[model samples]
Target: MTAITLIQGDITQQSVDAIVNAANSSLLGGGGVDGAIHRRGGPAILAECRDLRASRYGRGLPTGQAVATTAGNLDARWVIHTVGPRFTREENRSELLASCYRESLRIADELGARTVAFPAVSAGIYGWPMEDAARIAVETVRESVRETESAIEEVRFVLFDEQAYEAFARHVR
Candidate 1:
């Protein structure tokens, strides 16, 4: 079983193999975790994002899917970018939310990333309920590991605040 850890801190600071970004579909860097990663990771990350946009992901990355780029100045070796679904009360989109975790792990496995640090996807400006987001993130990562037999040995949920940290902790424990 993959070890799951909850850290109440910035995701960029973790010295892991990969850091998962809660990216917008454009992958051009927006607010929250996406902007922070792009700002700290430097031009190399944007350059690769440009290359991805020009080549395979011309129309922007689809929601619930994940792609990777160089970590640049960050501590990690790679950044797994995944667009999460915005919270919607009118429809049930928890599967898409769960897919964010699953796909990131799949990409992490492909990159041989043994340790990955992740922020609460869609729980920031996208307005996902913190508790539900935490539950989905934790449960999906656990389920994916059980099903795929991935190379990832550790999945760290690096939350920005105590509330978010405690929320994820509930599920992890």
Candidate 2:
């Protein structure tokens, strides 16, 4: 297995095997990381996302599910998109976000991807707390990396800013 690297960088700039999209259930792309991904990945990403929108499961996604598409203009060969919930009063919000990492990893493995990069899921418009989100994101990815039954060599978290970078970096140990 390849060693996972925690890098302070841009998800859009990283040349990993696959980049995880912090998307809504619609998958059509919205603001924050989603908007950046959509813009950098170009129109083809939207076209393919539009093609799959109607088939989106209830709650934007069934838990622990993910979809794949051409990376469009993004550096990676493909993008593994997963929807994480907005902070809500409902149950299982933590588990749902954790599933975003898990399901995306599962999809990456299926595609024979060795390296994957992720943004800080739900930390933008979704309003999940940075410190808590950082802890969960790191733990989830680390645990998933361990439990995956496929040939996933590396998992990375790419941060867009110093604050986010420091927050995620706190989990490196």
Candidate 3:
């Protein structure tokens, strides 16, 4: 069974097997959720990212690249960092953003993690409309949960704004 929840607060605060960061291709740091994660996850996260960025994957995030790092102050033990393209961008935002959720679960499964939390990707600096983003997010996670090998127990959409929270709540049940 797939259980999805909507919570209001910092996405960094959620305690789960893993939490996703709405990062940029660089993986160093960017606006919105990316910046918050970098700020709270501490220097180690970024330091590791710098090296990962240089791989064949390079520092520039490929669509499905979801990397893991130790959680510094957050309740989670690990952080699954994925770069999600902005919906407002002219590029194929849907597929890339969907990759963020699906690949995150894939990474979690590889790590044997059962629970994960995600924020509203691309809704901040990326400007994905709340209604559409919530639908895409819920659908992507629901679909990913069904397809992945990971024993995913729960997926959360943690919203920092009330409107976004309510929009997700409306779609999740």
Candidate 4:
């Protein structure tokens, strides 16, 4: 079984096997967690992202999909980049949101990552409701852990503020 933990801190600072980045499809680095990771993780991360863009992801990574790159200066060995869908009330994109966690974990399993830190994907600039995002994240990770024969031992939800922490806490507890 995988242990779920919550940490109210920066995701980039977590010393885990993999750090999940709520990245844009471009994979070229943008604001929020994406920019933070690309900045702190150094140029090596950007270099690899550029290569991914040039080679396979020329059209940019699709929402709900994930890929891996070097952690660069971060404590982890790999940074799992997952494109989260923009929340829309008119259309139900919940499955796509859930796919972010699922795909990220799949990539982590591929990389043999035992520990992973994830942000509240799409809860920031993408406008996903905090409570719903937390619920989906916690539930999805729990289900993914139970269903997959994965190496993941610990999954940490790293929140940047008290509200985000509390939101996730409700689900985790």
TM-score of each: 0.98, 0.89, 0.91, 0.99
Q: Candidate 4: misplaced stretches above 4 Å? A: none
By TM-score, is 1 or 3 better?
1
Model 4, 1-173: lDDT tens per residue? 89999999999999999999999999999999999999999999999999999999999999999999999999999999999999989999999999999999999998899999999999999999999999999999999989996779999999999999999999999
Instruction: List candidate 3 segments past 4 Å from native.
Output: 89-92
| Displacement of the residue 58 alpha carbon in candidate 4, Å | 0.6
lDDT of each residue in 29-111, candidate 1, tens digit only: 99999999999999999999999999999999999999999999999999999999999899888999999999999999999
Error of 3 at 10 (Å): 0.7
lDDT of 1 at 125: 94
* Total backbone clashes of candidate 1, pairs 3 or more residues apart or in separate chains: 0
Predicted structure with the largest lDDT when compared to the true one? 4
Instruction: Sum up the clashes in candidate 4.
Output: 0
Residues 1-173, model 3: lDDT tens digits: 76788899989788887888887888888777888888988888887787777774563877556888776677787888887665654555787777778888898888878778899987887778888888888898888888764487788788999999998988887
Q: Write the per-residue lDDT of candidate 2 for residues 1-173, one digit (tens) a residue.
A: 54556777779898888999988777788888888899999999888887776565433555446898889999898888887767765655898888888889889988989889989888888888788788888888878877765587778888878888888878866
